[model samples]
Target: MKKSIVIFGSTGNLTYKKLLPAIDNLIRQKRLKKDDRVYLLARHDISLKQYIEDAKKQVKEMLDWTVLEEVLEFVYFHLNQIEDYQKLNHRLKDSGYTDNVFYLALPPKLFPEVAKGISASGLVTKGDASKRIVFEKPFGENLESARTINRELWRYFDESQIYRIDHYLGKEMIQNILVVRFANRIFGQTWNHNTIRNIVIIAKETEGVMSRGNYYDKIGALKDMLQSHLLQMAALIGMTRPKTFQSEDIKDAKVKVLNDLKLDSSSVVFGQYNGYLDENKIADDSQTETFIFAKAHFMNDKWRGTPIYFITGKKLDEKRSEIIINFKDDTNLNQIFSNAKPNNTKLVFKVAPEDGVKFQLNVKQPGLSDEIISGHLDYCHTCNWVGNTTEAYEKLLFDVLNNNKTLFTRWDEIEVMWEIISEIQHMNIPLHVYDDFDHLKEIILTEKGVDIDAL
Candidate 1:
């Protein structure tokens, strides 16, 4: 997160729905200083009063009245008109600003322009206390576009100054995979090829595009989710120890996670959902894929040959997200009490609709019978229990204020992400057909206790 936040595309859906609200919540929790300035940078041509009222209404709807005053005070907007940007500059100077963060929350096409313009303004000095940039998803349409965004960011800022916001990594449980693994000696010792078998990271949403049909077509599931969000989760699950707690160090390990991936057609599966091509808003001839599932590998000593399965889609089944790790096959597999096993265990980190971690372990049934079974040692995070469980947006904004980059993404991560996903798209691997996707969809729906046909 960049300090003294300047958010581009502040008038967009993400800012109104996620960013500003999170900031308001954090302020209510007293997690931020009153002095931190959050400047909205958009071409909306709105007044300070107009933006303030819009943001205030957003805060009111997203939070209680307790959060409104401080939130409204800190949030100021820059219209980004030539004169407005200049006028905003004077306002910053008179206000005695120390740090600045430029958040590019717009579409991919606007990235280079915004970066170039911001740099030309001379506001992004390398010697500042903390100058960062926050950008949303679809960093690029593909490998070339990904490189383009990286190049643009490079022109204006160094690797450290760019904080790519992959909101998935900011989720509490997703972040805790490392914590659960490394903190507990028992789990950490067993987290390797010797014990773990298959790891599946699936981000599924039931509705197709909702209203972003055209945008969805341009960048399908492969680019939208797997390239950034799902892969980030895979990196967290498979990475070895890092040297430091810094974003650079952690991202250094993530790059290896990508380099280790099997970047070819074989030993992988890629699928696309096209059921909506003939539906209400989408084009009848469009080949836009709403669903994607792929198998990947890390050719490293620890996780060599371990299958990393990834699935993401917009309109599929229910709206659910999770990471499941399955251990290797067992011999003398008991059929009577099939759920039970000697060494098999599973750990699931739930990221959305709620935040929590649940693990599966085998044990004898709580009866006189000599049968074993599987059960969960569950830690579920219910929002009802919280005074301050910051949303991903709030946490990112706070990181910007505090100049913390640990929770944000780095460029190398983006590069590696594009390289891996682009391989699958370019090669046109022997993909699983519609039926296979439906089968997987059924499996996913089974998890939610819903029959696919019923919907």
Candidate 2:
């Protein structure tokens, strides 16, 4: 069976930085066989030779030269005017391919237009023949908008044919959260709120939105990071173990977990960097939030009373995405050591800048006296196997090619996510202005008791 990938907005940032490089990697790894064809669809008229030259300039440093050469041979350029589906269908049919995957790497506003064009053109694969469409998030600004988009997409594509990608789901450590919770006996035993006191999820960047102020100012950190990525991570870590690793089973658990999230006025915190107003294209009076710190709790018995803190922002002190699981400190040792109670065992899953796992434990120091000190059992994926860990886009793209939606977001999940966001938006929370990441941390700790000190 021959498959063709038609990528709209092929010259955009995502296509240049991630999509093409991932395709090149797939070819090098022999996952994307040579028989498959890649069509770069755009609104403008660009020669295939010129397009290839531009692509080469962007990805040459990251991709091997030979891999790029072989991958380029399978690539084709098309002047795709998605409004006319008949010509689009004719163009695809002429390419001599049946199975199709339409990847829209364009702005959210263009999704409906392209989808309608695909549907009206009737240029897709027939029943039971593999045809899929991939979309990136801001699934919609709010719940109502998300529902509308889902409805529009459903008109043309079946639920099975739609792929809503959340790249964070493809992170090595994010994928490992399930294994750590369900596969390991020790972690599995203490997975519930009874043993675990709380969980902290953090995604931070040191650089501000200097170049992307126009986009960042509109969406802010709440919608850009917390609503999709942080929420997804919290659901994965907090959800009950699925019946199996199958896509449906895992997705079912995630949806249920999200449905159990309780949001209130008191639990939400929003912030904007001090200089965010001064950024180009940003309004001085804009109330957009570049930082968010919220405490969310699960309504289910398995996670009752356990607070899951969500924190993320641009222009922070550090650049990292990690999950910190703090277990309840042991009281049994309080009688023996008097002042030295058993330390809280923390499980850390580092998701960015590197992939790794760290277990914080209390151990007796090497001395005549009984001095307890913190010890660590850590495994750094990048350190041990440098340049071997798969990029999030690489894993995600391969999953789309293989028609595996396990790491992808579903429509139902997106709807629930937007509902949660809408509730917070209606609360009219103030966006606190912070001078730096440390000041933001101080405010969080002082007000919410969320100690974001380095783990």
TM-scores, one per candidate: 0.85, 0.92
Quantify all predictions' global Cα lDDT against the true fold. 0.70, 0.80
Cα displacement (angstroms), candidate 2, residue 431, comes to 1.7
Residue-wise lDDT of candidate 2 within 20-100, one digit each (tens)? 887877777877777777777765566677777777776644666454554343233333454455765776678666677
**In candidate 2, which residue pairs clash?**
none
For model 1, how does the per-residue alpha-carbon lDDT over 24-141 read when each residue is reduced to its tens digit? 6676676655665667665556666677677666544545534344433233444343455566566666777757677788887878776776666666655454666777887878
Instruction: List runs of model 2 lying over 4 Å from the truth.
Output: 56-61, 64-84, 125-129, 339-343, 385-387
Task: For candidate 1, give the lDDT.
Answer: 0.70
- Cα-based RMSD of the predictions, in order? 4.8, 2.6
Q: What's model 1's lDDT at 219?
A: 78
